[model samples]
Target chain A: MAKAKLDKEKLLWMYRMMLLIRRFEERTAQMYGMQKIGGFCHLYIGQEAVGVGTVAAMKKGDYLISAYRDHGHILAMGTDPKPVMAELFGKATGVSKGKGGSMHLFDNEKGYMGGHGIVGGQIPLATGMAFAIRYKKSNQVVVCSFGEGAVHQGAFHESLNLAKLWNLPVVYLIENNRYGMGTPLERASAVWDLSQKACSYDMARATVDGMDVLQVNEAMKEAIERARQENQPTLIEARTYRFRGHSMSDPVHSHYRTKEEVEEQKERDPISSFQAYLLDKKILTKKMADTIEDEIKKEVMDAVKFAEESPLPSLESRFSDVYA
Target chain B: MAEITFREALNQAMAEEMQRDENVYLMGEEVGYYNGAYKVSQGLMEKFGASRVIDTPIAELGFAGVGIGSAMVGLRPIIEMMTFNFSILALDQIINNAAKLRYMSGGQFKIPIVFRGPGGSAHMLAAQHSQCLDPWFCNVPGLIVMTPSTPYDGKGMLKTAIRDDNPVIFIESESMYGFKGEVPEEEYLIPIGVGDIKRGGSDITLVAWNKMVHVAMEAAAILEKEDIEAEVIDPRTLKPLDEQMIVTSVEKTNRCVVIEEGWPYAGVGAEIAARISALAFDSLDAPILRVSSEDLPMPYAHNLEKEVLPSVDKVVRAAKKVLYI
Candidate 1:
C-alpha cells in the first residue's frame, strides 16, 4: 500500500506525531518502572503507525476515540502532553480536569471523545458519536479504535450492527496488537483472522501493515473517504504487536512466545520503518529530523514540568460537575 | 380545569412540547405506529409526522445512545421506554453516557433527553417485567429521576422534564395511567425536585410517589375514620428528594409512614424513612413505619402480584402503627 500525494509539511507532521508518541511512551515506561506512574499502563510500543498515521489522515473536526492503551492516540490526535500528564498524575489540569486518570483521558475540544477503560465500551459510544454527526447532518466521521480483544463484547456486535444498518460515518479501527491484555489473540479468539469479523456486518474491511505508516495512512485515507462520502462504517485490522508486557505489574516473561519471535517483530518496528522510509525517499535531511527529535524531547520535558506545577483539584470540587 | 387520564395528560405534554420546540423529536419502541406499549405516546405518528415521531426497532441501548448523541448536537429528543423494565437494556447509555457526558466532557455538552415510561409492577406481568427502578435510578447522581403519579403531575412535570437541560428519567406508573384527575389546559410546568402536599393533616406524614401516592391517598382517606387526619406528601423527584417539604411535613405531623411497590430492604421507602428520621428525629411521635413490596420475584398470578405490591390496607395499617392507633 502506498501513501497519498503529500507535501513536505504533511509528511513532517506525520513523522513528528510518531516521534512524539514513541518518545512519550518511552518516558512513560521509564517513569512507570521508577514507580512514578501507577495503575494499568498498556504501552503502544510497536503499534505507533496505526494510531498516529490514521489520526493524521483525519481532520481536526473529525472525532477520534480509543481504548485504555490510548496515550499515543491522544498525542497523535494533538492534545498537549501537559494536560495529558496532568491527567496521568490525576491533577486538575488534565484533559478531564483530573477526574479521569490515565485510562480515561478526554479532550472533547480536540474531538478526542475519550480513552475508555472497559473493553468495547467505546464501540457503542463511537457509533453514537457518529449518529450525532449524522443527525446534525455534519460531514465529520468518528474514528473508533479498539483492540482485537474488543470484538467479543456484545456492545461491539450491537454497535457494528447498528452503525452498519444506519450507515453512520465512522471508521472502526481494530488494533490487532496480537495479544489482548496478556493472552495472545490467536489463543483467545475463535476467528483468528480479525478483518473477517467486519464481513459479517457487510462493512468494507481491510488489513493494513501496522508496522508501516505509509500503508496505514493509505488504508485510513480510503476508509475515511468512504465514511465521508458513502456514510458507511469501515473495519480495518492493523496487524501490530506490543514489545512489552501488558502492564508494569507483569514481568517480561516469554511463556507465550520465544525471544526469536519478539526479535523478529522488533525488526519491523513502525517508528523505525517509517523513519527509514522517510530517509530513503530523501523527503527529510538527517539534521532536520534530529532537530525534530530534539524539539520533542524538550517538549516532553516541559510537559512534565507543567504537569508537576499544575494545581490539584480541591476536596469540595468533587461535588461539582456531575451534570450540566 | 378538565379531568384527564394520566396517559392523556402525558400525550398532551408531548403534543404541546412538539408544537413549542422545532428541535424536539419523539422516538422509541412502539412510540409512533403501535402507539406505544402503554399508549403513553398514542396516535403521535399522525399528529407529529414520521420525522418528529419515530417508532424504532427493539434496540433500547442503540436508540438511547442515539438520543444521547442527538442531544449532544442540539436536538432535544424525548425517548419513550415502553416500561421501566426495558430500560435495564439501555442502562449503559443512561448511566455511562447520558448521565456522565456533561461531567466527563468537562461541562462542554448538555444532554437534554427524556427516557419516559411506566414504572413499578403491573398485574400479570411476570418477574422479568414487573419491577420499580425508582430506587435504582435515584442512587445514580447525575440523572434527574421523575416519577409522576397524577394526571396534573404527568402533564406538568413532563413539560418540565422535556424543557430541562439534563438527562431526565421520567418514570410513571401503569396503574396510574387510567386514573382521572384535573389537569389545566393552559401551559404550565411543575418544577423537578419539588414535593407536592396532596392532603395535609396533623397526625402523620405519609410520603409516597407514582402509583403509591394513590395508595397513600386511599389510606389517608380511611385514616380519617379513626380521626388520624394523616398528611400525604408526594416526593415527585427522588434524586433532589424534596428535603424541605418532607422535613416541614415531618416537623408538623411528627410521625411518618412511607409506602412504595419496591423491596423494603433498600427501596425509596428506606431513603425516605432514613432522611426523615435523620432530619426530624426529635419531632417524631413514633418510629417511622414503612409498607413496601414483598422481597421476591413478582409472580404472574394477579393475586400473588397484589400480595407482593403495596396496597391501601397496608398503607392504612402502617399509618395507624405510626400514629400509635
Candidate 2:
C-alpha cells in the first residue's frame, strides 16, 4: 500500500523470511545427498528474494503457479514449512499427501495452485485462472513464474498471446537464473532480453535486479496494480542466479561455469545485501540479527525432525484421488 | 417427443446446459461465429453470446490447458477438439495435466471439463483424419470416457458430462451426425458408465459402440434369416464399463463377437474380450472373436478404404466362426 517507506518490523520480517528460505533449501540439499529426499530436487538457495518480494506484493486470494524450482515460492507465500518438508520426505501429512513430491507441491487453501513439473506446463493454467477471475468479475490477479528456458516452449508464447488478447489480470514473471540445466541464456535464447519476448503480444514488459528485494517488490506492486486496475498483463524478467546446480545430480564444476563464477555471484547474495541495508539504516542491531538467526535455525531443525517422524501414506491412499 | 438429428440434439444439449448454469461455457476452434466445424453448436452463440460460446485459436494445447485451469477453480468448460485426430497436439495437456491434476494435487481440485469432438473413421478422410482415440484416453485414470450412438443418447450423455464434476472424454462419430432418432422434449439426463442392449436375442452376443453399433445391427439382421439369433450390445461408456451387463449377455448367448473401427491389438474391443475372459470364463462356448479394421494406416482409395473397414459380412463371418454355424 505504501509507495516508499515501511516500518522497522516489516523490513525485519522480510529479512527473516528470506533467511528461512535460504536455510530451508540448504537443509533440503543435505537431505538429498543423504537419500532422505528422493527424485528430482531443485534448490532455491539464491533466488529467495524473487519469491519473497513478489509474494509481499500479492494480496490474499491472488493465485500463484510456478515451475519445479518452487519450494521457496510457496514458503514465501506464508505456507508452513512443516508440510513442505514432510512432502519431500514422502509422508502422508504432506501438502499433497505424499502423492506430489518436490516438483508438484500444491495447497489450494493458500491460493498456491501448484509447482508443476513439465517445463512451461503451468503457463496456460495460470492464464486460464486469470480468465476465471475476469469472468467472475473478481479483482484477484494471477502471477505465473517460470525459468528463462520455458520461454522457448509453445505454451509460453500461446499463453502470453491469450493473456494480452483477453486483457486478463495476470503477470508473467521470468526468473532468469542465467542457466537452464547447464545451457546459458545466451546459448538458449536468440534475444538476450527475455522480457521483450512479450513485445510480440503487445503486452507490458520489464527487467529488474532480482537480487534486490525492494526492487522486485516495487516491480511486482506496479504489475499487480496494473493487472487489477486495467485488466492488463505484464511480463517481468527478474535477473538472478542459482547458487546451486540445476539439481542435486548436476556436478558443480564440470561442463559449466567455474567455481570462481559461483563465488562471484555469492558476493551479491540477496539475503546478505538486504541484511546489510537494514543494519545500515539502524532498523536492525547486530544482537537482534543474531537472535533472528538462532530462531530460524531452530525452526529449520524442527521441520527436519517433524518430517522424519511423520508417517508414510497408507496403502489405500494410492487408490483414492484418482477421480473426484 | 421430437425426432431430431444427432447434431441438433448435441446443440440443444449444450444450449440447455449453458442456459441452466452460468458457469457452463464452450471454447474451441470455430465453436463461435462459425457456429462449429460441423455446425453442432449452431444458433447457440447468438443466444448465449460471445463470452459463453468462445472461439479459440488453433492452439489446442494452450486452450485445452486453459480449460483445465478454469475447471480447477469451479467453471465448467466444454472444449471441442475440432476432431479427435487434431487432439494429438493437445494430448500432453489432456493426459499429463487434465488427467493427473486432481490426483497430483491430492484431490484439492476437481477438473470439471469435457473434451468432445467427432472420432472414428469418416468416409475417405485417410489416416491422419480418421482415428479412433478412445483407447488412448480410456487407458488413463481420472477420466470418464463416453461414446454415444443415437440422438437420445448423445443429448442425454452430453448433459450429464457437463454437470459431472470430473474430466470427461466424449467421443462422437462424424458420419452419424445426420442420423435421426427420437428424443424426449422434457428434460432428461443419462448417467455415465451405463450400457444399452439395443436389440435382444439368444443365439449369440455381439458387442459394439458408437457408429459400429449400426454395423452390428446390420450384421445381426443378416444373420436372423439363417436362424442365428444375435443380441447386440452397446457399452456406451468404455472406461467404467458395464461389465455386469456384458457378462450377463455372454452367459445367455454362450458365444461373443466384438467389433470396432479401431485397430484390434489394443482397443476397446480387446478390453471387452479380456473382461469377458476374466468375468465369464466358465460361461463361454468358444473363444471370443474380434472384428476390427485391418492394422494399417487408413488408405485414401475408396475401395481400399472399404476393404480396410469392418463390414456386415466381416461381422457375420466372425459371429459364425464363434457360433460354428
Candidate 3:
C-alpha cells in the first residue's frame, strides 16, 4: 500500500515532538533514580510515537486523558517541560501545584485533562468529556489513552459500551505496549487483538503500528474526525512497546522477556525509526535533526534547573485545593 | 409550602436545577425511559428530554465516572445510583476520582457532581439491597455527605448538592420516598453542613439523619408521653457535620442519643458520639448513647428486618440509657 503523504512542516513538527518525549522520559528516569521525582513514576520511553502522533491529530480544544505513563502525552500537548518537571520534583510551581506529583499532571489550559494514575480510571472520564462536548454542542473530541492492561479493567469496557451507546465524541486510544507490568497480553487478556474488545460495543475500531508515527497519526486523524464530525467514538489500538519496565521501580532486565528481545524491539524504536523516515523523506535534514536534538536536550536541562530551583510546597498549600 | 412525597421533592429539585443551568443533567440506570427505578426521576425525562435526562445500562462505575468527568469540565452531573446498594460498584469513581479529583488536580478541576440515590433499610429487601452507606461516604474527606430525611430537606439539599463545587454524596432512603412532608413551592436551598432542630426540648438531645430522623421523631413523641422532653436534631450533612448545632443541643439537654439505620460498628452515630464527647463533654450529664441497626446483614424476613433496623422503640431505649432512666 502507498503511504499517505503528510506536509513537510507537520512531519518535522511531529519528529521534534517524538524526540522531545523520548528525551523527556530518559530524563524523567534519571531524575527518579536521583530521587528528584517521587511517588510512582511510569515512563513512556518506547511509546513516544503513540503520544506524539495522536496528539498531533487532536484539535486545539480537544481534551487528552492518559494513565500514569503520561509525561509524553502532556509534553506532546505542548505544556512547558518546566512545570511538569517541577511537579515530578514536588515543587509548588508544578502544573498540578505539586499536589498531583508524577502520575497526575494536569494542564487544563492546554486541555490535558489529567495524568490519571489508576489503570482504567481515565476511560469513563474521557467518555464523559465527550458527552460534555456533545451536551454543550461543541466540536471538541476527547482522546483517552491507556495501556493494554487497562483493557482488562471494568471501567474500560463500561466506558467503551457507553461511549458507543451515546455516540460520544471520544477516542479510546489503547497504546498496546504488549506487557502489562511483567504480564504479557497473552496472560492479561482473553483476546490478543485488543482492538477486538471494541467489537463488544460495536464501535468503529482500528489497529495501527504504534512504532510508525505516520501510521498512528493517520489512524488518530480518522478516529478524531469520526468523533468530531459524526459524534462517534472509535477504539484505536496502537500496537506499541514500552522499552522500560512497568514503572521506575521495575528492574531493567531478567524475567518476563530476555535482554535480546528488548534489543530486537529497540531496532524498531519509534523515535529512531521516525527520525530515519523523516531523513529519508528529506523532511528533516542532518543539521535540523542535530539542532532538534540539541534544543530538546537544552530545554530538558533548563526544565531540570527550573525544577531544582523551584520552592517546595508550603505547609498551608497542603490544606488548600482539597475543596473548590 | 406544599406537601410532596420525598420522591416528588427529589424530582422537583433535579428539574429546577436542570432548568436553572444548561450544564446540569441527570444520568443513571432507568432514570429516563423507566422513569427511575424508584420513580424519583419520574417527570425529569419528560421535562428535560432524553439528552439532559439520560438512561444508562446498569453499569454503575461507568455512569458514575461519566458524571465525575463531565463535572470535571463545566457540567454539573447528578448521577443516580438506583439504590445506595448499587453504588458500591461505583465507589472507586466516587471515592478515588470524584472525591479526590479536586484535590488531586490541585483545584484545577472542581467535581460539581452529585451521586444521589435511595439508601438504608427498605421493607423486606435483603442484605444486598438494604445496606445504609452514609458513613462509608462520610469517611471520605473531599466528599460532602448529605442525608436528607424529609421531603423539604431532600429537595433543598439535592439542589445545594447539585450546585456545590465538590462531589456531594446525596443519600436518600427508599423507605422514605413515599413519605410526604411539606416542601416550600418557592425557590429555596438548605445549606449543607447545617443541622436543623426538628423539635425543641430541654431534657435530652436526639441526633439523627435520613430515615432515622423519623425514628428519632417517633421516639421523641414516645418520650414526651413519659414526661421527658427530647430535642430532635437532623444533621442533614454528615461530613461537614453540624457540630455546633449538635454540641449546643447536647449542652442544653445535658444528655444525648444518636440514631442511624446502618450497623453500629464505626457508623455515623459513632462519629457523632465522638464529636459530641470532644465538644460537649463537660456539659454532658451522662454518656452519649447510640441507636443503630443490629450488627448483621439485613435478612429477607419482615420480622427479622424490623429487628435488624433502628426503630422508634430502639431510639427510646437509647435515649433512656443516656437519660439515666
Please state the Cα-based DockQ of model 2 relative to the true two-chain complex: 0.84
| TM-score of chain A in every predicted structure | 0.96, 0.98, 0.98
Better of 2 and 3 by lDDT: 2
Backbone clashes in candidate 2 total 0
DockQ of each: 0.52, 0.84, 0.83
lDDT agreement with native, every candidate: 0.84, 0.92, 0.89
Error of 3 at A7 (Å): 1.6
Q: Residue by residue across A223-307, what tens digits does model 1's lDDT show? A: 9999999999999999988887776676554677777888888998887777777888888779988999999999988887787
> Chain B of candidate 2 versus the native chain B: what TM-score?
0.99
Off by over 4 Å in 3: A1-4
Residue A170 lDDT in candidate 3: 94
Docking class of 2: high
Q: In what order do the candidates fall by DockQ, top score first?
A: 2, 3, 1
Best by lDDT: 2
Candidate 2 residue runs with Cα over 4 Å from true position: A1-5
Clash-forming residue pairs, model 1: none
**How many pairs of residues collide in each model?**
0, 0, 0
Error of 1 at A123 (Å): 1.6
Per-residue lDDT tens digits of candidate 2, residues A200-224? 9999998988998888888998999
Compose the digit string of candidate 3's lDDT tens values, residues B258-285.
8888889999889999998888899998
